[model samples]
Target: MTDTTTQKGDQMTDAPLLTDRATRLPAGSPDPAEDRSASTGLSVHGLRKTLGGRDVVAGIDLDVAPGELVSLLGPSGCGKTTTLRMVAGFLTADAGVVTMGDRDVTTLGPERRPSAMVFQNYALWPHMTVAQNVAFPLRTRRVPKAQTAERVRAALELVGLTHHATSKPTAISGGEQQRVALARAVVQEPDVLLLDEPLSNLDAKLRVGVRDEIRRIQQRLGITTVIVTHDQDEALSISDRIAVMHDGRIEQIATPAALYARPATLFVAGFIGSASTVAGRFLTGTPATVGADDTVLVRPEQVTLCEDSPLRATVARVLARGHFAEVVLAADDAELRAYVTGPPPAVGSETGVRLGEVLVYRDGLLAEVVR
Candidate 1:
């Protein structure tokens, strides 16, 4: 599984811990020459890690260009986090290599590698002040006091946490603490930044705000980044591309739009977004090579409940979700969901379904159907 491929030019916030979110640099913002990887970008070649007599990461290969934000997304125990750990030099790979530019750091220890990792727990020392916590890494390197202060201040400013620099970790909210962790990671300006579920600590409402802050900082810095998370919405919104892994292997890698619009495999289609798959005859041309009976994968938003539509389904339930209603329909043996505006039809009433974006696939391969 050893393969080497070069990639290039592929691709947060806080305001006062909240202000950066509102004024984040737009996507494709200009990055300084030094922030951009001039000599090397992060690359994983046939990386494998086996533990407990089983392969946790089996022959994985991924390339993240300078300034790109790629998310390793999958359910727990799917090896997304393991892959990030290996890249950070926290875990040794059983096979394959990791390179930053042309330097092979596969055998390097965590501190020896040219990377910084922000842990899931926000690993801030309760004994230290916000400034002190962010400055710990610099102190270890024996950085000059004057330069360290400047860098620390700059980092705190980047995450909009300068005002809370003197406060202890216990004194701030979870969102503010998370920003402190981010500040620590970027204080040294490493070649790559690795985030391991950085937003998991925050509440549901805070998650989106914090997530937006992260994107703002990443875009502003233009540093290569790799994030590990199981949340599809997080990956979809934060990443330049997503690598969906399953069973310790990469199932597919594509931009969020491409992954959702044209999933290469059935697994990717099912994993990345919601859809109701129903097997129906290829009324016209088959999407697959063999022309076998295919399934139509229709998203809930793609479904329109119209009175004049030819295809009808019985309304089983309708759950109002503020802006739209999640209407569940029973069409023959298939149970499907649709998003419709206004009040839902009475339970057991019939409604027509007009599907907008219909994807046809056969034997797990994307195919075109002329229905």
Candidate 2:
């Protein structure tokens, strides 16, 4: 995608391009122009919210560039929606500042902010045609008829829904309705797009397709986006960065690969993917020792079987898939599961297993044990 920017007073035409390869500044790279412009597109500082005398969003500090996709990922009721609402000006933050470019919108109403939101339910007007739905925002802004039609057509085409312009919301599939909603938001050409579980209503197969489409559209438009989702895979698949929330607090924020490979906390490690935590002790040299209460995390792929290995474990169960099998083992009162390529060992078989790559954490702190 390509962006053409025209600097004017308060109304600048900054068109963002979305493609497979979007250009980004390298980490910690400095740009004098960006510093002068305060080009950080979205900033949430010290955001706090409460509901029924309980703190929903304790505090959150986040930054998104002009064309970045960030996801707030966590289980249900972890305050992801509250934070998104705060950003979109749907809810006022008790103590914080929400800034888009240089404007502080913490106290602004939803309609006053230069942003759009796509709800989980699609929230399209059943009585309106796709074109009308896409043009709703432009109409609200009192845009001219010809201009509204042109922008609506462009937005619909961007979302691959140009052909459905005449279809009502009830006549289209769930995914198409969602595309209409997205097109509506895009027609406004807001500075940011806030998505609240936008893909949750679609079926499993459609969810995958729609998510890819959303990512493509977001990148193409170069709009800063923040998505709230409970599905970890969904967030990891589409987001440039993920902010994991737990207990109304932001736990960790990092790139998808970094968050998966080197999780900052035990909660993040367990929440991001499937992992097995085994009791073990860090030995001074050569090999680590197995013990109780000293948990070591290992991905299923980081386990291998060998007859000559020293660890003695009995195969308790075998769950076989097409390409790989999960072998559950009982070793010295500790239960662990290992992923092995090929056929699995039979139940009740005594097997020798070797640690492929173990991440040893003692007292919740990562330690440099030799093994």
Candidate 3:
């Protein structure tokens, strides 16, 4: 299935982003009835959506606390964006409730909900100045000229794009343009913030910088935020918690540490990080609880290489990975990958391998964590 969220230019790769009818910038104005003082926590219950006769988002329940940043992470077509859009009021849920703070906004349009979204494509109008772009949403609401200008100035300053306030979208760097998009969203001061693949367009170096900047700004504002991302590293680095989705349902929701240390299901184990699955009998530790029906997950960090150990393996492949080498070893008919620092053994060399702490799964569910 084609991804409905991710996109490049006008062509979409994932879910389509919401935009103004006349321009590519975001739509919606602040609703007069929205309670600004209400709880900012975001909650969704029994959300469901079907597209092309197939379930795109199947029964998703999520809660994002006020001032918390949670990421909806999964591969494309897994419905992370679909779920986000439903919560954002862009896509209506088949059966569910989307509540922000104390408001039940399931029937409200995007404009009426107290939420703001940052588009993945950074949909700033090419003809508009950065300040104008940031102030566009405020203008939609007929905000006073003085307040709009003040908000625009403050937004640019917050994103550190004050000097580029007068520049057109075509003139600024991609990273700067992305900041402009974020600034536009931040200026709204909405209770809930939604971002659709906010950093998918940036290069590696800029991604880290902007990601940290976003976290800083979100923390400063204390807004409830949800970010949809396919990048595990991006989610792990910024999110207070991550909801790992697969097949239109969330398989697990936990902190970065908990998700990495103990994934709830078989899909989560392979999705959150790298791992090698081996039969329980091949595992060197915890023989009492491990059996033929058990499968052991060996993370790269858990693979130990010591010359004096009794376990044996043949070096298969050594891959350079900048800070460390990913050494693939052939052991007991399974390939175990280890992250080795400094010099690594050559191919075809016999070496000692030992399993450290590992997760044991049975019937595709996390059965035990053998430490």
lDDT (10s digit) by residue, model 3, range 76-118: 8999878888887888899999988887989988877778888
TM-score of every prediction relative to native: 0.81, 0.82, 0.85
lDDT of 3: 0.81
Sliding window of 10 residues with minimal summed lDDT for model 3: 15-24
- TM-score, candidate 3, is 0.85
RMSD after Cα superposition, model 3:
8.9
Model 1 global lDDT (CA atoms, 0 to 1) = 0.76
User: Model 3, clash count?
Assistant: 7
Deviation in Å, model 2, residue 256 alpha carbon: 1.0
Q: Higher lDDT: candidate 1 or 2?
A: 1
User: Candidate 1 on 189-302: residue-level lDDT in tens?
Assistant: 666789998887778887887788778867776667898898999999999999999889999999999999888878888888888888754222334443337777777987
Clashing residue pairs, backbone N/CA/C < 3 A, model 3: 3-13, 3-14, 4-14, 4-15, 5-14, 5-15, 6-14
What is the TM-score ranking, best to worst? 3, 2, 1
lDDT of 2 by residue, 243-321 (tens): 9998788899999999988887778888898888776642223355544456688777766778897778899999877
Off by over 4 Å in 2: 1-40, 157-164, 170-174, 281-291, 362-371
